[model samples]
Target: MSEFLIVLLAGVASGALNAIGGGGTFVALPALVALGVPPVTANAVSRVALVPGSVASAWVYRREIKQVEGVATRDLTVVGVLGGSVGAGLLLALPASSFDAAVPWLIAFATVALACGPRLSRTLASSRGRAAVLSPRVLLAGQFLLGVYGGYFGGAVGILMMALWSVGTGLDAATGNPMRTAQVTAVYLSATVLFLTASNALSVPGHLTALLTGAVAGGFAGAHLGRRMPARLLQGVVLTTATAMTVLYFLRG
Candidate 1:
């Protein structure tokens, strides 16, 4: 029961983080690992379990979704799907030890990104002028790479996407968040398909069920709550959670 509750709470927190910013994997992945799942399998299972919540969050923002300035939404989605599939394949093909060793660094990078994202976005916005850079081709290429990363680990992928757009296009994070949610959903959607067919993600049915159920509930609730919460409060909550998770992972390593 204790383990079940811990997994459920992690799912809820992960769902909220994804909905609010983009650090869900930082919560979900480590939680599963703490419960004795192998790192690679945890990654696979996290991707699969979080899909419904991502989709739900995207659905909540559907009406707000719009084409980012200087970028083609349709083309980006295509590249996202393709890149996500490739990332998922690589995850299954790679040795388990490789992923285990990389876990600490991945979490560290993600935690720093989450912590610095807002300030970095602001700095880029101020100095870069409000003009969008990157031609359509370059933008598509960048999105593909980000999609690959999102599919592979997905810790701070949403924040990464927002950072890219903020630096390249001068688009504000608030304005681009809906699109971020959609693209993340796309990445997870493709990754989930691969995991379902090619991975052992479902071998632990109990953990999967608990996390998925909590994630879905959290997704719905977070979407509604996000609109009402102060932006600073949300950021503080996400940053605190991310910092603690990063420290824990480093210690475990």
Candidate 2:
């Protein structure tokens, strides 16, 4: 019962965080570790748990997704899928130590990206004009790389996606929300496939059942809230949470 509660609580917290800003792993990963799951196993388990949340959020954003430029959306999704598969393959081949050492730096970079994303988007939009800057080819390529990153680590996948979209797609931050959600959905789906098929995700502890359930429920609720909430406040929460998690990770490292 206690173990179940732990997973449930972690899931809800992670779901809310993921829906609002994208660093839910900060909570889920640590909770898994504290629950005595091995680091590698915890990473895989967290990804499994997160997939449902991302999917739920994507569904909630379906209406907004329809408004995206059709060509750009299709192209980016394709690129993201291809890139994610390659990234996942790389993850399976690389040494775990290599990624562990780099996680802190990546987190720090993601934090900065989220923090300044809005300002950067505004500047880019004004300089190149929104449509001109957001070329389909560039957006596709960038999202592809982000997909790989999401499959491999996925800690700040949402932030990275938003930043790339802001610069490469030139979408207004609020307008880009659905794109970000969609990108994350693609990455998570691709990663989950690679992880499961490769047998790399076999270590998920039974205790995580409750966590998965809560995440699914919370994700549904959070996504609904996200669509109705004020955009500014949502962005602010995401930035703040990401910044705090980045600092925490760096300090721990």
Candidate 3:
């Protein structure tokens, strides 16, 4: 019962944060690790379980999805799928010890990105038409790399994607959010397929099912709530959670 509740709450928090912005992995991954799942397995399970939440959030913002200036949406999606598959394959192919050692640094990097990404995006966007000249190849390359990151660990990938789009296309954070949601869904969708087929997520059906159920519920509610919540407030909440998670994990390391 305790195990179920812990993951369920984590899933709710994770899905809600993801629906509003991103950082679902920060909650879901840590909670699963705390439950004695191996780091790699936890990462895989979290990604698979959160797929529905991301999909739900994407559906909520479907009407708002639009093309980024320089790159075609289909082109980016294809690259994202390919990169995500490679990342998932790498996660399975590598030794578990390597992932354990890298967890703290990965979380720390994601924490910094979560903290600075929005402001950085805005600043770059405000610069004298600089982002307007961003090349399609550069944008596509960045998206592919981010897709790999999303597949591997995916802490604040949505924030990073938004920053990428903001800098590459001079798009505002609010305006870019729907696309961020969609692309993240794309990355996780491909990653989930790989994780389910190759990873150990199936071994813990109890935990996986609990998290998925909570995420489905939370994702729906959060999408509706996000419209009314202030962006700063949402960012603050996610940052606080991400910071605490980063510190706790670092100390654990």
Candidate 4:
């Protein structure tokens, strides 16, 4: 019962966080680790669990999907997907400790980016004077790298995507929003496929039955509520959760 409650609460927290932003794994991963799952396994399980939530959030944001225009969207999504697959493959091949040391730094960078993202976007937009001039090869390579990072350990991947889009692609923050969502969706889809195919999902203390139940229920609720949420409020929730999770995870590490 204790384990069940823990997983359920974790699922609820992760779902809510995901609905608002994109750091759901930051919550779920630590909870799974505390529950006695190995870090790699915990990561894999968390990734699997996150799929439903991302799908749900994507559905809720479907209306905005059409808002993303220009040729860059298709190109970026492909780059993200390819990058995500490679990252997931790397995670499955690498030792857990290899990533452990890097996680904290990544989280810190992401947190800082989330906090200053809006200001940075405005400043960058002003400087660009219309379209952000990006080297196609460089942007694609960067997106691929980011996708890999997202597949392996996805916390605040959205912030990274937004930053990249604002600086590299020269899009307004709001316009970049759906692109981030779409990119994340593709990355998660690829990661989930890789994780499942590799058959490396973590076996924790809690039962799959309970975990799935709680995660699905929470995901559904979050998706339903997210559509009606005010943009400012949603951004607030995302920033707060991302910052808190980064701090907590750094301490735990």
State each model's CA lDDT, in order. Answer: 0.78, 0.73, 0.80, 0.70
Q: Which parts of model 1 are misplaced by more than 4 Å?
A: 96-130, 230-253
Question: Model 2, which residues run further than 4 Å from truth?
Answer: 66-71, 124-134
lDDT of 3: 0.80
Candidate number achieving the greatest lDDT relative to the actual structure = 3
* Cand. 2 TM to true fold: 0.89
What TM-score would every model get versus the actual structure?
0.84, 0.89, 0.85, 0.84
Candidate 3 residue 37 C-alpha distance from true site, Å: 1.5
> Could you arrange the candidates by lDDT from highest to lowest?
3, 1, 2, 4
Residue 246 lDDT in candidate 2: 74
User: How well is each residue in 91-197 modelled by candidate 2, as lDDT tens digits?
Assistant: 67775567767777877776676666557767876876665456666666667777877777778888777766555544444666676777777877777787777
Quote the lDDT for 15 in model 3: 85
Worst 10-residue lDDT window for candidate 3 reads: 125-134
TM-score, candidate number 1? 0.84
Error of 4 at 158 (Å): 2.5
Tens digit per residue, CA lDDT, model 3, 111-194? 676566556655765775555545889989988998887887777777677666755665655566678788988999999998
Top TM-score prediction, candidate number = 2
Comparing 2 and 4 by TM-score, which wins?
2
Candidate 3 colliding pairs: none
